[model samples]
Target: MKQHIYPLRTKKLKGSIILPYFQGINGDRMVVPFIFWALFPLVLLTGCGGNDQKPEAQQGPPPKVKVAYPLRREVSEWDEFTGRIEAVDSVEVRARVSGYLEKINFVAGQKVKKGDLLFLIDPKPFQAQLNLTQAELERTQTKRELAKNDLARAEGLLKAKAISGEEYDSRNKGYREAVAAVRAAEASVYAARLNLQYCEILAPIDGRVGRELITQGNLVNGGGEATLLTTIVSTDPLYVYVDADERSILRYKRQHGPSLEGVEAQLEVADEEGFPHHGRIDYIAPSADPETGTVKLRGVFANADELLSPGFFARMRIRASEPYNALLLPDRALATDQAQRFVWVLNQEDKAEYRRITPGAHVGNLRVIKEGLTGQDRVVIEGLQKIRPGVKVSPEQITVGGEQ
Candidate 1:
């Protein structure tokens, strides 16, 4: 017995199917597969265009960072240190001759000049000694004149051969003895004058006086080791001694050589709260202190108004070098690790690239960047905590000025 075969066909229109079953009688089995195949593609297309489908992922702008243009400046830079103020010149008033102070010449704590009388001792005794010396000197001169007349007469007698040669020699010796007596009396007069001058005490230098060590009627002696009558200190010009660390000294040497004159210093009274009058570097240590590993430097300032007092604590700032054109950034912009000091730079590709930087001196609150970043680079000042290498970023502009 021969079996019958079924044929299937699909129509593009309406996506329906026509089939022949049992050679002439119609059977739906062949059309069933064709109809389902055409309808399946339509169902898939409707699902693709349906509201139930998800939309595409949305993208926002890249993260932003602030940027500042660096400026080149030529400034007088300085290194600062806490220092102590001292008098440029000072002296202690002392009694040269021992005596009872009968009178005080000036008030205590007053400014005095050279040769000014400071105190007076009892002058009555000195005056009496002077008078006695003068009277004795006159009496010695009268005897010397009389002895010379006797010597002349004795010489004439020797020439006339009227007296013995021995008698004439005796008279010549006596005349010489009288002249020696006159010389002794003149030395006594000099001594008396010196004693009279010692009765008054005078200032040795111009300075402000300190508290009086001895008051009027107080007996002071030269034998006393601590014979301090009073102390005087000069206040017109003052000294400021400052200390600098070894590192700072080395850095300054690299900039200004080993000489300190090329470096200028300014002084600010430590008690005062502001910029101070500028000064010059007066001296620097030849060697470093072993214990503290620092160098001692001193500066001199004109304290004309007495604004800077002796023994006052002050601040000394030394301008060690000239200013440089550099990129200045906030200290927070720098990230440090054991590896190196670096900062995040937002590249044109909107990526945060880590850049290594070599830092320089700190000018005010900003830090100088010696290497690794250009003036045009966008520095990650904010949002640095959130940034990482190769991360996309956006940059926002920031305003920054050079060190004043």
Candidate 2:
């Protein structure tokens, strides 16, 4: 057997050659052919490996995100405002007659009805005055009766020529003076009676009474610079006063056709979440205020349970727009780019696309999309940070407001 050697000329193997099947004389040239045949498959595979890697290197796993179609529902837009609760009727209870406050007839901070006795000023002085007026009235009546009898006799005497015309005229004049005096006495008596009645201070309105400003045994001047006894405020129906900007007022009037009579309103307190109390717009100021450039508006709410009270800080919303079909998206799906608002919508290729939208009033966790979106558009609600425009996403379809 003759041994032969040859160098492998393949780029994969560097400067090495191995001849395992050299059993002939002068086989150096045969070594090259033999090595090529043995390594041909490997060369072919190396070239194909580049092609196999191209697909994976050019592709990546899609970003996982949660998405859902925009919600479609009938929605009405509301204009929100900050306001305060006011009482429909409020009265300051005052002493009507001057005297010592002898008694307080009502408990403080309690509900009182109209004509309910609230306080008692000392009635003794008023009663004494009444009695003196009554006595004077009786005396005047007696004198007038006597003067009438004298005038009748003088008239009969004048007819019979038993007295002069001047004497008869004088007698009639005396009677007229007596009659005028009696009328004055009667008026005094009536005034005295009215004063006595005023001694018993009564509630002028049905309402909740405040703390007593003048307690029993305190001297209270009445009928002139009357002393304030307490305050009463009606509680059944409450007024919510709000000031709206001039532009907003005009918009509301335009949308509602210049009549706000039936426009509905809702109210929520500081600790409340949504507007739970319902009401109607009862009044809108005809003119806007020059200083604030806002119009005063008031809404009336039924407060039969007395849960609402005057002076409460409240959030109010007026239903200014009519209900219409609207597309809505979760607030989490919304994105803001500078001053413009936008959202990532899933295109047909399952890729994110930036879409600018006009947002309207917020309803719960959803926002009203006034434009730039349809009900069929899939919006990315979660995993927003993991994807951007034109990025492929693995979307998991979710129902709006459903558990993720």
Candidate 3:
């Protein structure tokens, strides 16, 4: 090797070293300097090691979710329906005789018993007519008495030949006519008496009366189209009319042997919470409505306090099954996939698993589970949207309260 040293040129550009090229006469090969080789590796290694490294981040624990076991209870399934209150006996009070209404004897919305006076028609005309008929009846009775004496005399005259046969026959005929006249007058008297009694309109049923439609001094028409004076509806024992679907009625028939008589029922009004009023199925329509496919039903209830009124909208529930043990779950826990309803249940590994369920009636806030659930399975009630299948969860067990 020639011991001749060339002028070295170097640069430190962007943390990398640049070397000047030296041409040798032999040009056997161009080789990089040892300093450049060693420094090139150092540059690469230093470049790779220059990135600021942060401590590896710590992963947090699994997401927390609330879970609960299914509520097992004894429940009586009931089929609910919307209905209306009706009266057992409803009557329209009207005057029977045409006359001026003299007095409205009952206060509007008052309780009245059968035979209680409700209205008073003018009785003067009827009374005068009755008196006239009675006087006429008395006159006919006197004439009958005189004719009877004459007939007796005529019979004696016929036997003794004191009078001719034609005269005796005439006397007998007069006596018969007089008796008929007396009977006719007596019949007139009875009719007049009935008319006089009709002047007072009385309650035909025990019930609460509505507001009087016609006021006092109004002439009430007593003929074919009678006046509607007021209305009365029985209150002690009332009825609830419901139109039940034919399908449900058929299901009930299968359970109760084709007759729904005496089937117990419960009811609640529009503003009520639960079914507090109790009654029984007193009537069921013999046929189903073709248009709506519903059957009519009537439930009779005791209204001792007269709290329930007719025409009130109500919800009625009829027992579908007796009390039996069943599993229940929260309705909010259910997840839907098109037509399917599913839920996320935790397995022994604390991982979420999908489950399909069949739901029955709704008891309070809980849904009766007809199938696809066991009491041992822990179901995710809260944080359902935050989880996926096989994802681990930190479950906090909770207890459900209130009615099942």
- Top candidate on TM-score is 2
Question: Each candidate's TM vs. the true structure?
Answer: 0.68, 0.83, 0.81
TM-score for candidate 1 = 0.68
Ranking by lDDT: 3, 2, 1
Report model 3's TM-score to 2 decimal places. Answer: 0.81
Q: Give candidate 2 misplaced runs (Cα > 4 Å).
A: 1-61, 257-259
Ranked by TM-score, top first: 2, 3, 1
Give the Å error, residue 21, model 1: 67
Local error of candidate 3 at residue 385 (angstroms): 2.0
Worst lDDT run of 10 residues, candidate 3, spans 4-13
Predicted structure 3: clash tally = 0
In candidate 1, which residue pairs get closer than 3 Å at backbone N, Cα or C atoms, i.e. clash? 63-394, 64-394, 65-394, 65-395, 65-396
lDDT for each residue of candidate 1 in 264-358, tens digit (9 for 90 to 100): 77778756644477677767899999999999988888777888789988888887667556678878788986869998887788688888999
lDDT of 3 by residue, 129-227 (tens): 999999999999999999999999988988999999999989899999999999999999999999899998899999999999998898998868788
- How does model 1 fare in lDDT? 0.79
Ten-residue stretch with the least lDDT total in model 2: 21-30
Q: Candidate 2's residue-wise lDDT over 99-190, tens digit each?
A: 99899998889999999999988899999999999999999999999999999999899999999999999989989999999999999999
Evaluate all candidate structures by whole-model CA lDDT and list the values in order.
Answer: 0.79, 0.87, 0.88
